[model samples]
Target chain A: MAIVTPGKRPGERVANSKVLGKRFTRAKKVGHASLMLTSLVDMFSIIVIFLLMNFSANGEILYMTKDIKLPSAQHGGQLERAPVISVSADSVTFDGKQIATTEDLQKGDVLNVPELEDVLREERRRYEQIHVNDPEHPFKGLVNVQADRKIPFKVIKRVMFSCNQSGFGNISFAALAKTAGEGKPLAAN
Target chain B: MAGAAAQPAGKGGKKALDAELNLVPFIDLLSCCIAFLLITAVWTQIAGLQVASSGGPPDQQQKLENTIDVKLMLTDKGYALTMAGANIDIPKISRDGAQNFDRKTLSEKLKTLKASLPEQGSITVQPEDAVAYEDLVNAVDTCMGEQLRNVTVAPMN
Candidate 1:
């Protein structure tokens, strides 16, 4: 009934115990190592890819306005340094000063000619002075406009026209940089 | 797998190995990142006139041509069209009629200015801070109507 030869029992029992111990230990180690490796590799690869893609786009400072929330457009790239100008929904600011209010800035708003002229004159004089000092150098200045994304094109045209008169030939609008974040906006500079 | 096959050879009954798979969490993370990149990529293309500068002796001579700049200042009251650096007088629209464009007078004035200019002349439109949107468009339309197509909305220098 025992199914074991009477003299072989002790030797067989010792051999089986040793073999089972070795096999169990090896299986435990392999399972732990492989599970850890899979996850560690997965996390690292994603991080590296996201960072590389983010920095490759254009180098531009984004101007955010309180009044305008620009809907994201599909076009993404880096823009060179031009003059930076920011227009809040109701006001325009350049070089850290309020240039015009919505009533002053909106194309539909009543035009205030003298004040607009004064601002343009001031901006132009500043640029001209900078260019005059370095005549040999091609001025790479651009007017970087940050306005409410929802404001109409007419307002943009008026702003552009004013800048053009002030002698800023280059203008660019600031957009949020493309990254692995949507509905969440990156901070604008 | 080899160990499991070898288990059946023992005197004891065959053992069982259990494994489960549900990859939902990993899939969720990847999808989030992909969605973010896709949505933010839309606003990337920039639109502006490319800067073109041709370097040569001829370009220098072209630059030397006496070009008069006409500045059209737009205000809420109306437009103050100026040229040769002198402020041009424009009659005010009554406050009640502030939004209306006196098209006939505007067109006539712009036409006269165009008639006096030579070919390839340029004008800088300077819209003031308080200019009405309709008025600015009217002014631009008027300038185009008068055949001054080489228009630049430049800031005052």
Candidate 2:
């Protein structure tokens, strides 16, 4: 048997009654905020995944040439944007400046090696500033050569030698997407 | 009186505690990423080239009325002629015959084929794997040398 307090009955205590309605209950306002945050986390995760997939897929679509034929290379190299030098059968041009031709580079022809080397060096400096400061940037040292099929290997060798002297090592050749019909032999101009 | 006192205590503290972990922000983020991925996946598959090798059957619609299938196999010596998979030996051209990429003979062969072709002449050059690059280049050059421009390089199957 338990003894009851003589001061007040447990169910009829006046102190509990006095404090009852005075205390305030906080409202469930966080409902909207929780829903908002849940959506945010979901959105960020999907973005991270999408970015990862996109960076990889970008590798294939990046280096395809629509207009020129690329010489087959024995050395496999990654395709990246490089300083483009377009060589037609008749002449060689760097950034639209016609530098030389078969006639201009023949034996006893005065070839401007120093001038060619200077231009390549300028390109290298420009590219380095744009692509090297940030570690994540992928456009490192690369040079794209768009040489015509008929351009003699001797002419290309000279250009390549100049490129090496300019301290730019990476190289890529541009080729036309194979098509039906007798493909045009690279013009010899 | 006792029930009235306990009611406010039970409701007041619990409401505030339930408000802490809001999920609204997280759901907003997920909606954006899903939309981005959907767009990218659709963009991945666009224009691409289809490559076909020579030695395969010519296109049915492109074939002339009576097409002659001349199979020229690149040998150590020179070109050997075949038709419908059977070898046809020409005189003075032995298995160990002239190994030089004889420009004269090659140009003559191309000229004959060019004359016999229907409106458009098509010759397929199938070179053996062991043939030197120079010889292959020479063979192609000779075909073109005779002004037989419609040619395709087909590897032997």
Candidate 3:
């Protein structure tokens, strides 16, 4: 009932062969594709190990503002986590909150600033309240101070005096650790 | 049919599946962890110089009272070494050129002081308003190098 044209059959065969050849080429390319995952995995493993070592040895992490630049010291132990009193060139801040300015602290030969005292008193009271139930852990009264290297010692002393009056007996000055031979003359002399 | 029979069933099939570990996601996670850890490593090196602003522990206070309290005043001239109880003063050695304190003389003096009073473990460094922080740190390092481990800072009014 159906009549097939000879010319049409040959053309159909040619098109089918072209499609089959294209499919074969694509299959070959895929077979040759290789992913070098072994080397990548090894490199990542080494990096992970190195990072973990550094993380474990890290001590107390203090959140210091950008305004203060801590002086470098060649000898000192790790810092302990405690309340921070930052003394920048322009302002004095307690835990990132500005309590007074350098001019206010150095004004009129004042050894202690009233505003800093009040803040430290409040901080002490809060700390006492939190540890009141734990008899074993009495209030250690340790404070960490981050003062800018440029700020005069006069401002720092007033802050320290305020902290002492507020019942903090132990004060720690935060400093950047100097690498060996970086500041050798200072230490040697 | 013959080729299918020739292929080992259990060992070869299991080996192919086991070799694939879906490492792309694992590698991505490891990379992120490494980056985060590397950033925080810098914070770990920051240290603290401890000072007893007020009275220390009872045992420490008793020991501290027996020993002499030495105070080093850093002025524009030089360092004024004073003994609280003995009432002794070491005259300031004027600055060498632009340098504030004669650190070499200061170190030698501190070394001599330590030799005489081996019991002395602490010294209070009081810097004037104009003294640079670097000079203060240098003074402190000198004190520490002389084995004065307990260094406290006070301001000279």
Report the C-alpha lDDT of model 3 over B46-107, residue by residue, as the tens digit: 86777776344334333554478789888866778887554334444433434445666777
Error of 2 at B40 (Å): 16
| Local error of candidate 3 at residue A78 (angstroms) | 1.1
Report the C-alpha lDDT of model 2 over A91-171, residue by residue, as the tens digit: 667776867764555444322356667899898787768777677865434566665454544455456556656764444
By DockQ, the candidates rank as: 3, 1, 2
What docking grade applies to model 1?
incorrect
Off by over 4 Å in 3: A1-33, A56-60, A187-189, B1-29, B35-41, B54-60, B64-66, B83-97, B100-105
Each model's lDDT comes to: 0.51, 0.50, 0.72
In model 3, what is the error at residue B21, expressed in angstroms?
A: 6.9
Worst 10 residues of 3 chain A by lDDT: A21-30
Which of the predicted structures, 1 or 2, would earn the higher TM-score when compared with the native? Answer: 1
Mark the regions of model 1 whose C-alpha exceeds 4 Å error after superposition.
Answer: A1-38, A56-60, A71-78, A106-136, A149-154, A173-189, B1-157
Cα lDDT of candidate 1 equals 0.51
Candidate 1, TM-score of its B chain: 0.50
Off by over 4 Å in 2: A1-78, A108-112, A177-189, B1-157
Winner by DockQ: 3
What DockQ do the predictions score, one after another? 0.04, 0.04, 0.38
